[model samples]
Target chain A: MARIYNFSAGPSMLPEPVLQQAQQEMLDWRGSGMSVMEMSHRGPHFMAIAEQMKNDLIELLAVPANYRVLFLQAGASAQFAMIPQNILNGKTKACYVNTGAWSTAAIKEAGKYCEVQVAASGESTAFTTIPAYADWRVDPAAAYLHYTSNETIHGVEFNDIPDAGDLPLVCDMSSNILSRRVDIGHYGLIYAGAQKNMGPSGVTVVIVRDDLVGLEAKNTPAVFSYAQQAKADSMLNTPATYNWYLLGLTLQWLKGEGGVVAIEQRNIRKANKLYQAIDDSSLYRNPVDPACRSRMNVPFVLADATLDKAFLEQAEQQGLSTLAGHRSVGGMRASIYNAMPEAGVEALIEFMAEFERTH
Target chain B: MARIYNFSAGPSMLPEPVLQQAQQEMLDWRGSGMSVMEMSHRGPHFMAIAEQMKNDLIELLAVPANYRVLFLQAGASAQFAMIPQNILNGKTKACYVNTGAWSTAAIKEAGKYCEVQVAASGESTAFTTIPAYADWRVDPAAAYLHYTSNETIHGVEFNDIPDAGDLPLVCDMSSNILSRRVDIGHYGLIYAGAQKNMGPSGVTVVIVRDDLVGLEAKNTPAVFSYAQQAKADSMLNTPATYNWYLLGLTLQWLKGEGGVVAIEQRNIRKANKLYQAIDDSSLYRNPVDPACRSRMNVPFVLADATLDKAFLEQAEQQGLSTLAGHRSVGGMRASIYNAMPEAGVEALIEFMAEFERTH
Candidate 1:
């Protein structure tokens, strides 16, 4: 069976190899006589899988020795509350840069625990661009400065880390994590929901600097406490064992495919090809500023809005799927995460051109 | 490949049929051209799977119309905090029945959010027996009376729901949910981590009565708020797509196995046969009171403690694996959840008899 190019923003595609490996081992993982799903998290087999997953992620990202890596659950949405809970310490206020839907979500959850101050926002531009860092009114006294590295909905990406100086820099990299090389040292904390580039939709990864670990707001749920999870080696309770192992397989695949550096180059090429095709087209338009457009999620509108339905219906008939935009907004979105090959991007471009010529 | 009689508690085992079905659908789900892992949670396919899963669970549990079903993440551990966060509405205190490890955890997390009153505890008897509800110091003024339906670590099960007349009855049925039929109308809320008696680890199920749904405490994380989750149909974030689909398969398998009533009969036979074997043995002992013994996780100690390692090793050689008891209190634990067939339990009994005779 031919697999279609899956472009869903998240719960997106995993490498075919990863899915195959998981399928082959669905009943017995490495002859353990039990499915990975049935293995105890504290058992040696799962523990090894968990350890290897952490080590590989650390190696891939070159995470500093002082950072604590945790495989958590709930998702990045939980991190919206957890980051402020764990990082706010004694500070009653935090600074945020709002770029799009996700950044807005972070601000909303952060408001639950502390005074969230938006240092800058792109709402004035309908989330079409990120405000220049020079224009950001960052507060040095705030607990930390938070930003979403890539806004999945608006298709805005931060090309460079925004400077937070003395305040810790926290980022929501859910849509773009591991798609590119990152300097882990620049952020006090980093988190991503594993549905996108990581693996599937169960495990959530959090990388928190050591010094930023212990402090938690009163009444922080134990599941949301980095210090508690770190102390327990993230086995604060039963983990999503199967998802963890699937993620491990994805990490292994990523490494076998030449690690994050090679993946980043491929991601750049795929994004460039798609963006170039859109820019050259008379029938399609992307509203986000080119300088800050996401290399992960590309939202574009058909020149004739009336043709949108027919375009999507035909795309599916031709084995391209999930290219529809997030329902909150109206245009079409193509999310080419790490697992999406440049060939998929090329196919999408070819489809666009053919559909336009025929019209 | 021949499968083993896996006895690991929690993340323990799944029905052979469920595993086989999942393997068959691992790459492409029903000609969808993508793994369920790659599907968007909001898409029609996954939405149907989610709806079917909920219906099966409701039919199997006889869930009342006034109750709401939610698929959540993190785990039962997250519910330890969330239960109080959502249930403690205007009430300054809550009642708890502490039976074992999970019960103790619930009390601890609840303490973080409210004034917890231990109505009854098994600590006086080393958690080997459930205290009678008549002996409980239950407070009618408390918002809720919470308990673990089965103490997984202690091999104790509350044979009857504890009486909590005016107060809401909240239960954590993580290890035993769906193993037996439950009267949903009796419970204000019931939660289970879906690793045992359901499908795999990752997704959690919460069944909450309508009137008890909306009262989230201030600062409750949106991800932890059942009202918000129930409102959004639990897509407040990406639901654990693959795990969610796997659970759907398990529910389908459960229904095909004649639903919970039939499974409960099988479970009863399996538990009785094993318990009788242990009770009849000169070289084994089970500490939990027979009146409230668990039908799911049966913890036993060898008459000769020195032979524990030999037993586990030989059991592995015999394709009887993970029989070692929980480390906190160890000798042997044979978790015979619904997935554990009666034949497997008989095999364990035969193994116990043969080993006793040989030693």
Candidate 2:
């Protein structure tokens, strides 16, 4: 296989060890004579895997005992709709902090279920900075205060977790989950699509405070109800078994690499290295506020407008793939999730420096 | 590795060739140096796979030029809600035939969006047989007539297609899809979960007539809107890529094995062999009516109730697994979808005969 470093936003890189383990077990998982995909969700083999996955996630994230962790299907976008359906409770109003594209989408989906209050926005700075806490106008009676911890598109992140006081604080941690430590008790719900720092795209991790169950509107579909899904152990319907297994392997990989705290240090170092390259060079620039630069996704722009395509093409040739930015926010984005090894980021920086010298 | 045959209802068995290919491609798919799971949905590598999957499904189903094919996440159960949201078209009544567990779920979901009318039912006979078309009470003004072609739980199938004339016909073909060829023009819509006869459980294949588009209720989430999904080529949201690839590979395998027509013949033979064993023995009986006996799922009961646990345990020892029946209907169910080679069925029959002799 050719040497390659994947930098795609998501459905991104996974730990090599996890992939290797999964490959070895593809046909016969743990001598069960069947792939994980071939086992029934209700079967003992799969039940064990499901239980281990839940247990590992709780340990990795330090999720509170009072919070129910759900292994859901649809991606973060699906949670965009689910959050409101489950939490709105006919409150008709919720506070939203728009950091970038994903939070905007969550807000839009939530709009269908409730009146959204824009608590704060960084749109004035082209979504490159987190809105200051002082500017946030949170409604005390709102159902919940929602935010995106890491904006994959804008490369902006919250330096300090927002305070919701007595209100529920919900965070879409899709891109940054497991890359660092978090206080589980601070938020009522934290959801992340598995593709980024977790595992794959099909399974989503939802950590919801136990008291939030049974809060869904009567009109909510059974599939969308947290209470119903939790009751069924995320198996009210068939789940993506292979994906779930792959995620479990990923959790095992995380544990082997000294868990989230250790991985978080590596993530911090990787982010610092890439940001330093951009900061030191006049050829490249990241627009995010230094205090709030995202450690997971780093979106940057070229000093020369014409260098964008050339930079991506040369990067691809050098084995750096998916360096192109999201079209909604054009230039470049390197999503250095937990799976992105330190070497890959260093190589990227080295390549960026060389490219700058040549250009 | 110990040789074992997986008899799961879904997230079920896959072609050995597909599994091998997937394992081989785990690190780099088509030289992209990324597993299909690791690629972005919008990237060239994944786009090609998505388009190819759609085209292969179209060709396999003989889908008409006017019909749209969509690859969606959320299993067949999700479509239960989507069907009504997209096709209801302000129509209050829709006709449904409750053949088994799947159909019952479909009817329940449809009830959420419309006034549902049961056109016919097999409940009177414990869901062992499909009701005759002449017995149907379909509403002429109903937006569509819906039915499940095969019930995974009851081992009942619709041997004959129903004619609805101008009234659109919809079938949840989850368990029996790709098991046989059918005229595409017969139904207005057909959707199947990938786990049974297709590949895995994460993705669903939806074939919608062109005319069915543009009629969705505004309240429907964009993810549920078939029109939106079709327009986006099923990339409106992140899809289950590995499952999609598996389905594509399974489709290729089916075609290589002479397509659904030849497979149907094999399926018929296999179903006959199992049914024949049940018929020849006073020791065992399949409660489903012979005419409606499903070629895919065969639910059978031993005349001696005490033999149930022994049957499952001994069968497992003999390389047969998941012979236990659904909890709702107490009996053994062997879901012998297209992927279950004739040898597997023959082995099952032989085991059943031997067990009967001993017990």
Candidate 3:
């Protein structure tokens, strides 16, 4: 069987070229006589690989000179706890926007370390729309303001960065990071798991401004301390060597496809086509607000719930894999990240149309 | 270039068969039309892979029914903190044995969470030998007893498990796990980073007894909480999926190579031959006590300090790579984990003899 377009919410599709490069180097990486997985993290061979990866990511994101990029483990989920641990900075409270599942999770974790002020919530609208920023009641004494840039499960995304006044703005960009260009200067910190837009799972990329690097709470694990990790260049301990290599390969591939700017254009085209098909049909309807629907993960439901099983079965047969939405929201979701090509989205559209016509 | 013998301390060599299998399935895994890296961790394909890998490890270790094996991220470095956080069980003090560099580091991290009581110290002997059990000061009031089974940097290993008596026994087996057989029933928890005897660097394996599962200190990150993560089957977050697959492949390869018993025999033979060669040579010497010298990492120094650079250069030219000792204790170190074949060890011994004859 040939490669199929994997629509998994995460650990999803990767570009063919990146996989090919990794496959080619599986036995010996660039004549070094060791696979990337086999290299010592501190040795010259792996050091060079690590340096190039960090520099490439900084360049691609146009990260500011005052910021540090760290390649970490445990994904964005770790950052939920790390955010308050590193930057609460003796403050007693933190403000969080409750957008969807990811946001709610971050808020719950933050509650463990500090008083959590739910500045605003989309739950009132069933998480289908972003709450109006004007209605948010952020506490002036809050240490930081946090929000999920793109909710992977609810399919909601913030179109613009929210102002945090004097507090540092933190964002979880796990699902839509490299797919679009953003000014890194806008946030105090940005973190994303590599599984989605970057590469595979294991590595989490954290971009933090200078001021937010230090000031970790007492008893914070060294691995989760942004200040300690940044000083060591994210090699404070043995890193995920092979995952870093794969991430570097993916970033290089993204550059060859013309960096984030070019990929954003492709992503918009793909998302628009799929959403257009959904809106144009009576059988299928997307519940998310038109303005804030996630371009990375597009979730929709069929008019008749009985067709969900048949729709998924036929999609799998056609090589359209993992189209089922999250169990919490039972329908279908097409996660077309940067690695997901326009052709894959078109394939989904065509299949949906044919299924609607038949049923 | 063909694969060379890699002797790095931790992120070391993997079996070639495992790499070959991973490469063969890089693009599409067993006709799934998707790479293993691209599969949803919750999907049927990945669930099957995860199950098989866990069962194989359990079978290879002959793990008792009362233990839970977790595939986690952040390596054993994170476990340094997690062990204290999860099992302090309201006790203020925990006993720790300081054998070498790894034990020292673990003690440092554990101190942040609990009152650390030094049970024994090999430091007085420059970490070259383990202290006698009768001389160890076991604290009856302590929550647990922590010891590093093998020290990669100091080239020291414990020949047998230390009795913790009433306290739960925790062992950091990062560098030598699966290279020897051990009774799982003896331990309350056994943790290891996967870079050495396992597979790669991203995943950390934690095998914990059922009795030690729940008790977590307040503010422990949910991902690091044994009770929470065990309930979620270690998928508390998006795990290092590809790393888990690689680990599984490595475990399968180990099973084919006759499991831990067979590998232990090979490891002992490899260590003995390497040690005999060093002892026979006038130019080289191993400082560790013969009774407790590691059967995994063999750290040695040349009689002539000036020959260090030349030794490394010439060794590299002979395709013997990463033989440099850890920076903290410089000379030369050969980490011959379970994946290293007898032929590779023979090649190293032959090279050393030739180098000694000339210089």
Candidate 4:
């Protein structure tokens, strides 16, 4: 089966092996005489899959023993309200670093339940760079300091982990998670949308320090309450069983490919090659500063915007599909996630060069 | 490929055709050279699927022009909170009819946001029957009157839509939806977890009257807010895309089988045969009142309680799997959803008869 190099931001490309294995097992998962989608969540079979997926995530992230890994349904967008509702504890205030669309969204949602202090912002820079750490107005008495590790729309990333002092650091690592290695112990809570680096769009993987598991704010829905979900093993409701099992396959694939550290190195090489190619080209340009440009989602605009449609159509014909940028930030975004092979990136670079010459 | 009849309560059986279709498209969906899992939710390919799904549902349910259909993520448990947060509007109190576990859960979550008035409850009957409309004590001043149409665990169903007078009737049709025909116009809102008779978990279909769309209580997260979801065409977030696509397949299969009216007839026959078999047996009996017994989930207890383990084991061996009842209410539950062929029901009856006679 010939496949295209998908760069559609998310619900984007998945590991081909994962998809093939899932197809093979779609009719009957592991000789259970039923698809994973057909199993009862409380059944022993589903329980095993759930346990294995959780453990793999723990090992891949090298999650501390004090941290709890949860596979919650819905995307990180749900976490916007859930975070303040769960982690605020007794504090009526929280600090947010507005990096781009994702962080700004969180700040807006948090404003509903608490006093949100804009600790730092890259809005002044047109989201081309991250706000310097020292410029952040840290609220020492706040419940937590939140930021987006990677701004998907703006193509801005924070390579350096900002210190929140004694306060817990909550990070929305949606677009860039599992693409590189990071210290899991540094964050009180970390959430990544599965559609990006993980699996599909059905689940969100949340890794939260055990201390953040309890102490929920009042009137919080049980489904959104971190304490409740952790206690229930993230099975407070029937999960997206098909999505969860498929995620397990991806995690297994990640392990087979020599774990996260090995993948991170490959990712760095791919990102550098694509960025260098774009930098050398007069017909294409990436707006973000080199130091903090996202490795996962690289948004580059054509020198002439009129060529956007032709470029996308030609890319599609070349089996390079879904290269459209997000409407919020009009340009072309190639979300070369972990599933994207380095060959795909090389192909993209070559195609860009050819297209640039013709244009 | 040989398939077994899966009797799981939810995350239950899907039409084999849907599974086969999904498997065929896993590698390359309609020559798009990408799996549905890899499709962009906002792109034409996925948007077409999403659009088809919404239209199919509208046609099948005979949804009124005044009602809006929304596909949202995270299962119906999330809706337990969302419903109260959105529908309570300006009212501080809402009336709820408690028939079983699902209703109880909804009540608990609703209490977090508003005063839940238990208009009627069948807990006194051990949740074996739906409270009669005459016995209801609904508050006339309530924002809406809510009830669970089918109790998954209790094996009780309201065969008739309860009279709520001028008040908007809200129904949680998780188990029984689309298995039977109901007047969509009667409900202000109808939410069902797409697991049982629908498709899979992760996506919850919410059908609400258009007039009820904008009245969200303060601090309602956009993901849960009906107005926001409606405005965004249910793309408030990425949504459970794979789950949504699979649901569309199930809806198509339903149409192929002649829509909800035809399925309701088949469900009625299936339920009758199983109930009759139990009623005729000396060693088995269904606890629910015959009038209120669920057509989808039929729970029965063996006369010899100690034989439960042996019954389950032998049934599994014979390929009648997952007939074990919910943990909350133990025994045997044969959730013969729409996908379960009449032949499977005959096989189950034969197995039950044989098992009972052997003991």
Considering every candidate listed, which one attains the maximal lDDT? 3
DockQ of each: 0.79, 0.69, 0.88, 0.73
TM-score of 2: 0.98
Considering the two chains of model 3, state its CAPRI-style docking category.
high
- Give per-residue lDDT, candidate 4, residue B155: 90
Tens-digit lDDT track of model 3 for A110-224:
9899999999999989999998889999898999999999999999998888989988899999999988889889999999999998899999999999988889998999999
Tens-digit lDDT string for candidate 4 (A1-359): 47889888898898989999999999998788888998888899899998998899889989999998888877899899888888899899999999899999999999998999999988998989887787899999999999999988888888888999999999999998888999999999999899888888989999999888888877888888888888888888888888888889899999999899999999999999999999999999999988899998899999899999999999999999888888988879998889999999999999999998898
lDDT tens digits, residues B180-236, model 3?
A: 999989999999999999899999999999999999988989899998889999999
What is the TM-score ranking, best to worst?
A: 3, 1, 4, 2
Q: What tens-digit string does per-residue lDDT give for candidate 2 at B1-359?
A: 67576677876778888889988998888788788888988899988998888788888888889998888877888888888888989889999999988889989878877899999989899897788888889889999999998999898888878988679999999888888778878989999888888887788889999999989987677777888888888878888888888889999899899998999999999999989998999888988888888988888888888889999999999889998988988879888888788889999989988988888
Off by over 4 Å in 1: none
For candidate 1, write residues A1-359 as lDDT tens digits: 57888889988888999989888988888888889999988888899999998898888889999999999999999999988889889889999999999999999999998999999999999999889889999888899999999999999998888889999999999988988988999999999999999899988999999999889877888888899999998898999988888888888999998998999999999999999999999999999999999999999999898999999999998888988998899889999999998889999999999999998
Candidate 4: what lDDT? 0.90
All candidates: TM-score = 0.99, 0.98, 0.99, 0.99
Measured by C-alpha RMSD in angstroms, how accurate is candidate 4? 1.1
**Of 1 and 3, the candidate ranking higher by lDDT:** 3
